[model samples]
Target: MPEQPQWSERTLDMPPQDPWADQPTAPGTVPTPPPPADPAPFSRGRAQVNPQPHHTQRYAEHEPTGIGWPGAEAPGAPHGMTWRWSELRRGSEWTTAAVLFAFVCWGIWALSGGGPLGTPLIVFAVTLAVAVGVFCLARVVGYVVLERQFGRRRRTARGSHLVTALFLAGVGVADLQQTQWVMDAYHWVAGQIS
Candidate 1:
């Protein structure tokens, strides 16, 4: 290895001279070094720990590494690959197929052909449609407001949302059969438009 250069022989910038260099110091006084830059940001002065951990004794010894321990992503997502209309086309197709099947079931009931099985099939299809629609809408719009406001950490746990959606869907289907709320809402919207 090449020999290191002496400080006198090296090219170096001059250190700033102390303004108080001319002042006489108190006998045996030691000058203090500058305080370190903050470790974690946005913090006030720290409290003393009674028993500091051995590992943390050399707190600033290691260089920072921002990586986390690797593992499988937590199961269901908003994890990788944002779902767009193109990605959701397959789901749209399935929904369309389900709706058609429900229509066919309704027609069979209307014609008075398939009596016992007809109503059950229509109910089942509508339920499936509601469940699938809830999930699709969630996937599409869940992140829009959430990601803007709170990032990934602030996402509301989806289990409650799913449960609430399912309950509403059940109520909607019941209202569809008994109350004709869709017709009422359509007329209400038309009145508002007019």
Candidate 2:
């Protein structure tokens, strides 16, 4: 027969293993997680315990001072009767530059005999007509849909339709005359160049 295994009384009475038993601790102290960091003054999640009145006053004092609509003012315009160049330059510097460059290139190409003057002239006429149509459509939509349905009044729309119509009619007459002027100018430049 195999020899019987010896079992000590201390081993028999001992409790099961505790994972945290080896960790150092004071006689009566317990371990705790670290305290959280202080929240920022304007953090999203944290509430403002003490809101500053001066900040609100400062923001209220700064009123918005420029035309709200894009392209509402002429290029290189001053602040009087239109948006200043500084205001228009914000977020639109590249776009403004690109449009001016395109116009310059188009003028050079037209003068260089890229195609018959009629092609670009007719295209410009059609573009002007479409622009006027879209402008009128927008006015109608603003007055009927936005103002009536949404109860948001666009005060400018009241007389803007008449003004825009008159302006577009004048532009149409000018556009018709512009073709002859452009052709004359292009020929004059071509004569000087050759």
Per-candidate TM-scores read: 0.28, 0.27
Mark the regions of model 1 whose C-alpha exceeds 4 Å error after superposition. Answer: 1-115, 154-160, 163-194
Error of 2 at 21 (Å): 99
Q: Per-residue lDDT of 1-194 in model 1, one digit per residue for the tens?
A: 99999988887775557752444446798756546755654456786779955774643343334443335333222454355444445335444544555455444334443347666667666766676667656664655545433445233335324543455545444545443455577679999999
Q: How big is the positional error of residue 43 in model 1, measured in Å on the Cα after superposition? A: 54
Per-residue lDDT tens digits of candidate 2, residues 1-194? 97767676336664447843455556889876546746635554665589656653433333343633543443333322223455333434333343344345445545655568888667555645664575456556655665556645343443433444444445444443456666687789999999
Model 1 TM-score? Answer: 0.28
What C-alpha lDDT does candidate 2 achieve relative to the native structure? 0.51
Q: What are the root-mean-square deviations of the candidates from the true structure over C-alphas?
A: 18.3, 18.7
